[model samples]
Target: MAYDEGLAHRLGEALGALPGITAKKMFGGIAFLWNGNMLVGVIGDDLIARVGPEAQADALAQPGARVFDFTGRPMKGWVVVDGAAVSEDSALDDWIGRCREFVEAMPPK
Candidate 1:
C-alpha cells in the first residue's frame, strides 16, 4: 500500500531546516534520517517515530500511539502515531522533535 502523500509533504516541510537530514524511500514509505539514523517516517498514513527504548513507554501512553510492528514483531524503541494524532502541524512538529532528540544523541553511523 502507498503512504499518505500529504503527510509526507508535511514532514518534508517540517524537517526542511534541519542539517544533515535526508529523506529516502523505505518500507514502501518515506523515511527521514538524521546523520544516517532513522528519525521518523510515514507508513500508510501513520507517523513512525524513533522515540528510543528509554522513552518508549511514555510515548506509547500518548493517545493514538502503538507499537511499531511493521515487521510482524514489534520494534522496542519505536511507536506508530495514528494519523489523526498528527493532523495538526504542532502535533507533527512535536513528534519530529522527539525523534530528533533521540536520533541526534546517537553516535553518527
Candidate 2:
C-alpha cells in the first residue's frame, strides 16, 4: 500500500477543524497544507512534518523522528515521525503545533 488509510483518517480528524487547511494526495500518500504551505503529511505509516529550519533540530530530537531523506540527501527542515510516536492525540498535536508555526509564516501560494 502506498499509505495507511487508518493513519490518514486519524490525521484528517486532527487537522479538519483548522481553517485554511486542505488535504491533497502527494508523495504517494497525503499532505495537509495550510494556505498553500505544506504543514504535515503521511507516507505509509509515518508522519511527515515540516518544522522549518529553525525548529529542525528540536523536531529531530523528538522520539521516532528522523530527517526526511526520500531523495537520498537529508532534508534539513523536514522529518518523518514514526506511527507509534503519533498514535496518541497529544503526540500528533505536538507535531502539528510545530509545523503550524512554519506553515503559517509562509506566503499563500
Candidate 3:
C-alpha cells in the first residue's frame, strides 16, 4: 500500500516545530529525528513510535497500537499505531512524546 504523504506532511510539520527535531525519508517512509536520533516514523498509514521496552506495556495499552516490526521479528522498544489513533494532534503528540523520551536517552549518532 502507498503511504499517505498528506499525513506525513502534517506529522512532519508538528515534529519539526519541536526543538532539535527533523524529518527525513527512508524505507519508503518518513522518519522523525529527535536530537539526531531516530525517534519515530510514518509508514503507510501507521504512526511508528519508539517507546523503550520499559514503556512498551504502556504503549501497547493504547488503542489501535501494536509492535513495530519491519523485519521478521518484532522490534523491542517500538510500536506502530493505526492512522485513526493519530488523526488528532493530541494523540499524535502523545505518541511523539513517548518516542522523544526514548530517543533522548540514546547517544547521539
Task: Give the best candidate by lDDT.
Answer: 1
As a TM-score, model 2 comes out at 0.95
The stretch of ten residues in a row with the least summed lDDT in candidate 2 is 1-10
lDDT of each: 0.92, 0.91, 0.84
- Which model, 2 or 3, shows the larger lDDT? 2
Question: Candidate 1 lDDT (Cα, whole model)?
Answer: 0.92
At residue 37, what lDDT does model 1 achieve?
95
Model 3, residue pairs in steric clash: none
What TM-scores do the predictions have? Answer: 0.97, 0.95, 0.89
**What tens digits encode model 3's per-residue C-alpha lDDT throughout 21-56?**
878887678887877888888889888888899999
Residues 11-105 of candidate 2: C-alpha lDDT, one tens digit per residue: 78988998888999998999988888888999999999999999999999999999999889998799999999999999999998999988888
The alpha-carbon RMSD values of the candidates against the true structure, listed in the order shown, are 0.7, 1.0, 1.5
Off by more than 4 A, model 2: none
| TM-score, predicted candidate 3 vs. hidden true structure | 0.89
Per-residue lDDT of 5 in model 2? 82
